[model samples]
Target chain A: MLFKCLPPGAEIPGRFPGPVHARGKWFTIDIHCHVRSDKAAAMVEGNAAVSHWFLETAANEQSRRINRENGARTRLQGSSPEKRIEDMDRMGIEIQAISPAPRQTYYGADPDLGREASRAINDFIAEICGRYPDRFVGLGTVPFQAPELAVAELERLHKSLGFRGIEIMTHVAGEDLSAERFRKIFARCEELGLVVFMHPDGFTEAASPITILPM
Target chain B: MLFKCLPPGAPIPGRFPGPVHARGKWLTVDIHCHVLTPQAAEMVAGNAAATRHPREVYANERTREVNRQQAERNRIQSTSVEKRLEDMDRMGIDIQAISPSPNQTYYSADPELGIATARIVNDNLAEIVGRHPDRFTALGTVPFQAPDLAIAELDRLHKSLGFRGIEIATNVAGEDLSAERFRKIFARVEELGMLIFMHPTGFPEARRFADHYLVNVIGNPLDSTVAVHHLIFGGVLHAHPNLKLVIAHGGGYLPAYSGRIDHAASARPDCCEQIHRMPTEYLKQLYFDTIVFTHHQLEYLVDQYGADHVLMGTDYPADMGEVDPIGFVEGAAGLDDAERRAILGRNAARLLNIEIPAAAG
Candidate 1:
């Protein structure tokens, strides 16, 4: 499948430091990014409020406090693939490892439906990555709540779908990644050498170091 | 010799994973705790204002956006030491490792005064820890703005005051931990074999991760990620092979996000300079705290990094701490008793090189 924009090894504009004289052209890659598309948001909007609440106030107020302390902009809502690419171009980011939002993780979702949702989200990311192969790479999502299904999806993601790695939360709804239920996923990830991108999901709201401060 | 109100054995009373059944009987150790006194706050107030800005809403909505996105309930300023100790008692935590706030970091202050202020802060911390030796163990503050003076203070902290380790931000002011100016401190820390408990201040404005709540929510983690990233990618780890770095906040998203770093570093020459080792290899050399609060998270952390690399942490006085840290670790799935022991206290003891008195066991 041909992705939009340039193919591999094609020269893309770069973002470098210092004056243009001192700075040289460099390849760009954003290893961390999210899948916040209007379509993606719509697909998950029914459950968005719940996910947002959990995500918005994780670690009690640690997330909020840290955000305030650090003086960052608001969270990234879903953006169009075109806009993302344009932004990438502007920033000279050649490739981004894109995945779904941490709140969208389907840990507590119904196993069958969770598997389906995971597939949908993964498909969407893959399509976006496929559109810009030189500019984007997909980090597939897993239904970690359903390990067997998670393994199946991971296999599909790696083999059939051709993703670089998988995206997982720091915990599954307050459960740590080290739980017994996740042995298969961990082993498979290790065996397959699939990059397990552990994103935070406000799982332990009662225990965030950064979140303890007031806004 | 027993400290007042410091119950026998541990200040926290109870057995592993159990309630505070026995008041002040169990031996609990809070490896990561902060002791903020009014005097310390006053000392910080003058210099810290430069770092702190009033929450802006209109012209700089990014500030508000970041605040709204990352605001929390627990106010560090509102906390008192007595209340902190009381809470510690309730949580079954015994000894606490206290450090000064970002103000005491003296990043924006004059280097000389930064050194003096650091000594004063360390002196105050030492007095508090001394007052309650059984309940408190301090990780002294360093004046990173001045490296030589920082090392001198570390020696004073270690020899004179008996602080176990030196607390440092992920970056010294704006410089990466692996930079040339800070190498002396890292070298001294490595040579002394004292633990370097790395915490993040904020990413440099160039990164501006903290500017959009991106800094704290994503920035702090990314900052720590980048800090460790520098150590791994910048050859800091290679140079200081024995540098003992204990990264706070579950290694700040690095262990989990490592594959991305390794993948990117391998794929891009610019990402990593002529480095042969994977990012995760250098990561293994570093230790992390169990500040990451979920069972499965802890499980994966232990599984990915191994139990020995994990230590107990409670960023006390701040709202982000687990009220029951021991229970949280014990309750995490798949950890055996030995793993539990290693994580809760032993790992910290080994890393800090503190003697786990045979008498305690």
Candidate 2:
């Protein structure tokens, strides 16, 4: 909140610009902000898991209301780049490293569907960063259900987009992040020097406190 | 640190008084112990929802069979005062802060029924503590769904019943304790200077945890993890900094996999917007019990939380409980004599407000 954003593409001379970069001696980068990708959603529209995942609530009363209320607000000021810039300025945020919300990760969907959706999301993030190089950075996602495909996409995103990192869910479906199969994907992220941001869509094993015990 | 069972002819306490213990200076306290009151159970009879649990309904045959045997053992071992005392003596526990079982908290019943059930449950614990002042303490329960009534019960438990603390489910019905509606309950507990002991009953997502009893194994810990994370992320911890909330099952899965929480707090502005510091830092403020079931696991908890923050918890009468609880700690290399004593009794005495009587001459 203290530091303001530097003009787009401004770089400090004689200094290695790090993740936050320099803005009046302190760079302000919001590592989280959700940007929905219509392309990504369309790619995975056929998966029942993806649809079920979208409807899952972590069982917080206030959160459910907020999501409900945001639907009306979203109509007023959609996630346009210019609108986001206005918000960042209002909140005193400088550069925002953005990724799609956890629903777009598609860990439970069909592997091929997930792969296509991931590429679409990554491309969308890349274009946004390209358009506002000074104010935005891209964080990609991969089709983590199929780790091999996920690693391949990691390589592709890194080589083409030169993005800083990827956003991942805490668990892949009901599987833990530490499951042996997904270790290779993490290993690839390390090799590419990318940040793996993990966020949880809900509790593992579908453990909602509100849901009734099934017969 | 050694004891031999007292000679049977010489008034050997009850079931088994265990070996004659060596003259160890430290007292041992079992903070996580459960008792099911017969009166309360009878009251809730025919009310199936009062006792339904996801783990019970969804367990495989193997688990169901095991639970049946465990329930049988619990009935014989927990209902009889003489049997419980003998078992406590055998286990080398100096005092047990007994509370209602997770199933008997009765939060789903009508608010009036919940209140009545809590009273019966609390009275049963108080009577036990009243009879054995040195050997037992009471940890009451409340109807969390009705916060106003919950606060009143909290007051009655503390002032009238002389309870040291309370045992609460990880969530109420479906709402987390972090819900705004429940803040008054937490606020009252903190104001009254009472400890809040949290235990998990079940996880309700059936398909994800349908077999092999994972609803208890994975689901229980996950439930605690979710509740504590909400308390952390939802700003309950911030509002009541001094709330002595102790979590069951070794503080569950969060401590082990806390890197993700920290990463999110740093990346997501909203994650840390309420809290003053990183998420993992708050792990120190809370307390944990030693029912994790492994020496190395116990050692790690002591190491992470400091022995002072770790207390002895044997989920008594349950098959999953830490059998040989005192010995479990004695095996942990991380705990020296002082740290071991702190975890075994001294810390519980300080927090639970128990005053250890002078050793018999």
Q: Which candidate should be chosen as best, given DockQ against the real structure? A: 2
lDDT of 1 by residue, B1-361 (tens): 3234676666432211224422343334666666543554556564553344212211146666534443332233223556656666666776677776543466556677677678887888888777887667778888887888888988898789988887887766555666667777888888888888887765444222324345455555656876887677667786687877888888887788677776655434444552456667778888888878788889898999889888788776453455568878768768987888788777777766556765553
Count of backbone clashes, every candidate in sequence: 38, 5
- Write down the TM-score for model 1: 0.57
TM-score of candidate 2 to 2 decimals: 0.68
Candidate 2: give its CA RMSD in angstroms: 9.8
Per-residue lDDT tens digits of candidate 1, residues A57-170? Answer: 533343355445422322332446776765666566667888776666767676776787788888888888778777778898888888999999999999988898988887
B-chain TM-score for every candidate: 0.82, 0.91
Give candidates' CA RMSD values in order.
16.5, 9.8
| Runs of candidate 1 exceeding 4 Å displacement | A1-215, B1-27, B44-50, B53-81, B206-215, B274-276, B357-361
Clash pairs, model 2 backbone: B3-B19, B4-B19, B4-B20, B5-B18, B5-B19
Model 1 achieves a DockQ score of 0.03
